[model samples]
Target: MNKLKFFVAALLMIVAGTASAQKTGYISVEQVISLMPETTRIDSLLRKYQSDSLNPQFTYMVQEYNRKDSMVSTKDSVKLSAQVKNQIRQELEGYAYQIQNWQQITQQALQGKQQELLEPIYRKVEAAIQGTAKENGYAYVLNREALIVVPPADDLLPLVAKKLNLKVPAAGAPAAAAAPRR
Candidate 1:
């Protein structure tokens, strides 16, 4: 009974100490990358990839081919028209498939590259954040980005940057968009 009472007293003291400790700051994963130079480059590269005029050109070519195909089929060019129409249809479908595959490949490439580029830096930042919290006697250092209901005053992006020795980018920094294969 005496040992049980002692353990209970110790546990209560520990909880009380924890409850009274101070907490440091928070930042979002998005904000973290925005501050990094590599992320900016990645954004720029992807934008150029997705904006080529291939779609419009493909549509125009397909339409022109179909019109000629109908004309040739209507008179005495039946066999040739069938071959031309089939070829045009195949080309149009091929372009569509290429677009779908490009989208998937681009997404995968960016994700993999981003993870590779950011892993070491993220680890360093995480360690620095924990050290800051412990040194400052913070009871809980929460990620406001992960939480839906952080108080506005508790948004700690600036504090986290300061502690981690990282600079936040100025407003309107352009992100890179890599060009996808045509």
Candidate 2:
């Protein structure tokens, strides 16, 4: 019995030592991305895409809807064939539906565009974070946003930002403003 108790105590000590050796760090990826200079350019590109491409598409859809609606309203329905009238009505309804949901459609398009533009930036940040963690002997890096009761882990933002050649605000300075959500 004494030998068994000694073995169990030894096992516990080993486990505690292993746990203590592993270092953890936390970082806010959004914060890092916000500090990246490319983010501003990406925001500008997204706005241009919305104004130049999406807006024109919406305008064309509205014009087509108006033209079809006017044809159905102003023309003599009595003289029109039943099938032709039904087809035009269906087209008008489709256009109306699209127009009604334009906001959702445009938002999705903008989000997709934003994601495409930010993909490379995300990869770059990921690489920097990994390098920082390895260089600083961190065993795990947690997302700051995901934690509520964070333990005494190192804040890896400054280290990761430096690794990426990005500037971090001085201590006690206001946190970097988050990038605009699409």
Clashes of each: 16, 0
lDDT of 2: 0.89
lDDT (10s digit) by residue, model 1, range 1-182: 99999999999999988776655456564565456555566555455433444345445555665665465556555546667767756765665565557657556655665565566667766776676667666657776546877765655566667776668555486533322211
Total clashes in model 2, counting residue pairs 3 or more apart in sequence or in different chains: 0
Q: Please tell me which predicted candidate would have the highest lDDT against the true structure.
A: 2
Which residue pairs in candidate 2 have backbone atoms (N, alpha carbon, C) closer than 3 angstroms, thus clashing?
none
TM-score against native, each model: 0.49, 0.88
Off by over 4 Å in 1: 2-10, 20-25, 44-100, 152-154, 164-182
Q: Of the candidates shown, which would achieve the greatest TM-score relative to the real structure? A: 2
Put down candidate 2 lDDT per residue, 50-145, tens digits, no spaces. 999999999999999998777778756667788988999999999899899999999999999998899999999999999999999999999998
* lDDT: worst 10-residue window of model 2: 173-182
Residue 104 in model 1: lDDT: 74
